[model samples]
Target: MAVNKLVYYIIPLIVLGLIAWWQFGFGGLFENLKGGVKGVIEMAPNVSIGAEEELATEPTIPREHEEAINNLVETIEKMVTSPKKNCFLNYKLLGKNYGTNSGMPSLGEGGTTISFQLKGDKTEMLIAGGAGGKQEVTRLRKEIAGFKPCVIAGSNEITKNFFNRYLGQGQILGDNYKPVSIINIFYDTDGDNGNAIRVPEFGNEPVNDEGDNFEDEGWLFKAEDGSICFFPTNKVMSADDDGLVYGNINQINTKVGVVGSGLDYCYTWTE
Candidate 1:
């Protein structure tokens, strides 16, 4: 029994020694491994240059070059700032620049807005025009779907058709049929075709804006091609009280896709 137990233990020892010899080399395997690990540890710091070991130097620009840079910076600063806007002059709108007139004139004394006389539906337009420009809505709605700034496409003809249908009354007739008008005088003009107007400029006066303050009311007609502008006036007006006028191109539409005919009776007074 003792001899059998010794044989079993000796067999396991022999198998383990063979496995170790096969995995490692014959004798100095552990010593070689220890030397390799030590070599890697010793070489690591030399291979990697850390942040503390980095060398940095300040850059120095020549005097003339530095001056030139400063001047260029100043020029850039000025370019970034817009020329002071004069309310009495034309403005390059940053928005879509639809260039439609705002129905309200800039009146510091009173805030203004545009109100459309809604037909509720196309049937009302047919009843109102009695064969005037009701068909214009078909084309007009198509135009309105594609609105963008400064695009003068089919707007002129549409404007004409719209004006042919509706007269340039200041305020839209309310639910009542009574002729409601603006407190000021409105304008009357001929038809619309390829007309252009430099939009009227009023001094920008800050509004109290406690509530009832609006700069203007206008209409926007966009085309499927993303073309549109603002029409502030109900009708195409040739003149303002200040004798300034934006041509009929700015004539938005009536209650349809566009607005009414011309400028409403608004006096732009400063507060």
Candidate 2:
């Protein structure tokens, strides 16, 4: 009875969300979600989060587990922000060596995968490829949607490989290798979840690359647009031509579970 009622309620909402996306826009879906509703756009009808995204005023993670989550977030932040600066300059940007740091969950694969379990005394540490030995590979990417964990990644060749190889595996790429163009963000379950967006804006470059500038633009930070909005997690129906992504998945975090009954939104670029 409860299951039937649940299904009866969710189906129309999903359809309505899609129709809304088609008619109104991405903003419309969010508006609906904020209005105490949940829905998916035309891409997939598998999403079902409650007031989690909007009303998750407190951290759903157990108080004891808070430390582990903090450690994981801090590590991720370090990797995303400073992983490249320490590497040799030549290979930083072009090399597939600089990207997300340790403590990433294995999406699914042989060596690089981690079993989802309680983060006990281990403190949720994911070593970089070189430091961790083997780069954890995100195999079975097709299983992302079916699996509840929203820890997935997408990008171009160089960006993808670096994120997996170095950050996930701790292995640095060859010399002069380009670092990753990163846009990773974790929605804060505690408070101010709204401000937790990773790459805010992606747009055209106003200034052209001249010889005088010591800081040249590399693929790591370069993009077709100024901001990367609701990424792979964002609904396909709402994504504009520049916001679609279809890269192979890169897994992060071993503590697998839904992001607190909230949609783990991501954007993938498409040709």
Candidate 3:
């Protein structure tokens, strides 16, 4: 009975010793078999550990950028709750270097049109001239994703201030004056077919340059090609004969695949 019991215990150890020798090496086989199969397993590395966690995570937006958006949100909220029941705001995207042409008022094809009409507490926005339009400002924020600070590409000042550059001056829309309508007329003037305002690639996150990022100082379009430029107006509405808000292309960061530096011009009240 003792001999049989010894053989049974020895058989498993012998098999384990052979496996260890074949898989690893004959050098540690004896030492490994001292603690049975458990020792060999513990010695073996766990190759599955790499898959336990994700290789990368999404980038986080800076806190200052977040604050900028909040400020703009506050401005929009006030507009929605304005006393004017027939409030209307239209946002248009024009080319980067618009109005720089010397002779005659250069006209180009309009691109990316967004309109908003106040409804009680919140304003309903229409994006891209689609049939299924009319979403609230809150929904627009979700689509914008987030904002990043403006950074010049291939430069040391990656975190430089965004509003330091020169952007042309314009009168802020006064509270006493409310916007009725803003219309942009485009003419193919030269017939070269090149004057049309280039439309930004909507629904895709903007691929900024190495130093490129964003700021929340401007009005965030639902799909403004992932950029944040200046808000066209101070008050919710504008009643000026020439209510035009031009986006400073130089002020915005470089976009990888989009034309112009930032958003185009938003024209209002010129039929």
Q: Report the error of model 1 at residue 54, Å.
A: 46
Candidate order by TM-score, highest to lowest? 3, 2, 1
- The total number of steric clashes, by the backbone 3 Å criterion, in model 1 comes to 35
lDDT of 2 by residue, 17-101 (tens): 7898998799876786666543242223234355343222211222222333344333323333332332211111222221222
lDDT for each residue of candidate 3 in 115-205, tens digit (9 for 90 to 100): 3333433334332211122222222332221321111111112111222222333342222111211111122233233212211221121
Query: lDDT of all predictions, in order shown?
Result: 0.27, 0.27, 0.28
Evaluated with TM-score, which candidate comes out highest?
3
TM per candidate: 0.18, 0.19, 0.22
Report the alpha-carbon TM-score of model 2 versus the true structure. Answer: 0.19
lDDT of 1 at 46: 37
User: How many pairs collide in each candidate, listed in order?
Assistant: 35, 45, 10
* Candidate 3 TM-score, C-alpha based: 0.22
